[model samples]
Target: MPEDVEDPMDYIRLHLLEKLQVLLTTAALLAVVYFGLGRWFRPADPLGPIALLPGGELGKLLGIVVVLLVLAAVAAAATTRSRPEGALMTALFGLGGVAMLSPPMQTLFWSYPASMQSLYLQMMAEVLIFAVGIMLAEGLGGLVRSFMAKICPRWLWTNTLSELSDQQRKTLKKSRIDPMWDKNILNGDSLSVSSGVRNTLLWNLLSLSLHGKNRTAAQKQVFRGQLHRGFGCLFSGVLAGIVLLVLLLQSPERGQILFALFGSFVLAALFAHHLFPVRTFFVAWMIPMLTAVLFYALAAISGTGNRPQYQVLPIDWLTGGAGGAILGFWLSGRWREIRIFEALAQAPPE
Candidate 1:
């Protein structure tokens, strides 16, 4: 096989190991923070009274185990070809995380000593906010994309395609030379190539058009068209961030709430990049950062008395947005590969 064509089993094994490492590392860090450092950072629980089991420390350990199991399941599911299943699992995990963090549930299940309650609450709150943000952004962005694809002007898609470089166009054309190309590529109804070469070509073409240097006039036109379409996602992300901000405002920890807002913005942008046809990294990163900054500026200007100091730092914003964008790009590529695999699996035997 070509070096670029990875065996599916190898891919699965490599990613599964990575996920396990991440899961283990995260669990260990959490344990250290909760058990080792909890006393040092103890404060009043901002989330207020939480439920706790009668079993004390042992019960908390069990609950933590359950949470880890859920996370493991999510990670495993994410590596599979079933995007819907992965997304559903993620949503469920998010919901469960939030419920577990709730005051009643926290009191009932969590074993944090009174001194550590504040720190525990803070940790769980961060997890809950991230989960909720991801669920909402991905779900809402997908819905919006589907809706827009149906009603949006044809010019957008056409212009975007027209922007492809000659080389990229040739690659696309070459991929479509097969007998079943019309039933697949043109219709956008099915995958045609058994090797996934077509999908790879398409992905590379788009990436080059969006990110490659020395773009021709046509490529620039495509970039503009993509930018226009990407505005829909930009709007969607901003709206989602605003909603998260409002929800977070209800929480007692104002600083953490703003942090969640920033997180939501990043998630929104990542979801938008993954779901929308526009594949540009600039759009993926800048839209969310700009949206957050714009909202923050407006809030600062409008507020009375001392201007509210924005809690989100530039380093945090850059890191989060860039990380999310890179992940989105990677996922997009993986999805293309998966699509090719499926198409090949379904194609009639020679």
Candidate 2:
């Protein structure tokens, strides 16, 4: 007789419903901000020329995006009833909606008179552009994966998971530990372990409870390896940002707060990785994420040329370092791998 399996789908459905409620609540809050507070802080009179592409069109675009998002959520719920990935998709849709609506948030901060319908229209247009940009980003990720699979079939999971030969299966069975069949695609690269450690570190930082190890000394090695690998990742971000800045060199009133916030996120993540060599959930995921959010807020404040914003960036850095350590430690426990935090925590006290 087959063993009874507990359905994860039921839990997923419940979570999806909860997320939908949260989204609806957020939408209600936005509506209040747009209608209530926006009336009091009206900005300058409409002095700009109206383009052939009107603002109402932008609002219509947002409505279209909302419809598409709803469809995605429905498809995710229907297809992934029993899968955790399905629930994750639902969350992604909810987050995407929030990002799409963020451009219009500034309108709530200030009031506009009836004469400045053009200003409101311009705001709506900007919101649509921003939403489209974010959507493009999400689409680009999928496009890259598609291209990778087509050009490097062996590296893609599609080919990696092909039916195994009898000899291959027998060889795999002989090993005491489970073999990573995907490793074959890497052609025995020496950096594979380091790469795995780097990827694991990011995941661990996000959720300290992901599958990990118990040994402390080994975990420390993994942390060091991840740090080494992260150097490349860090530089890549800086390089990409610099390149974008260079290409779009116009001083179009770029918000200091945005840069500061992003900078703080990077700083915090780096700090967390270096400090708090403890393997617990609280330290890794919670600290880093909180630090990132705080950094963003501080950067926003700093962009206004407010002096207090400078101090918060340093705090963000420290929190990030703490988060990294906590994440490293927790990852060690989850993956049964060596991480720096685990090693330090397990060290003999003097």
Per-residue lDDT tens digits for candidate 2, residues 150-189, read: 6654432221112334433333334312232223312221
The residue ranges of model 2 lying beyond 4 angstroms of the native Cα positions read 1-94, 101-105, 108-213, 216-223, 230-235, 238-350
Q: What is the lDDT of candidate 2?
A: 0.32
- Candidate with top lDDT is 1
lDDT of 1 by residue, 90-113 (tens): 322332322223332233224433
lDDT scores for all predictions? 0.38, 0.32
Model 1, runs deviating above 4 Å: 1-10, 14-225, 229-232, 252-255, 305-316, 319-337
Error of 1 at 49 (Å): 27
Write down the RMSD of candidate 1 (Cα, Å).
15.7
How many Å off is the CA of 126 in candidate 2? 21
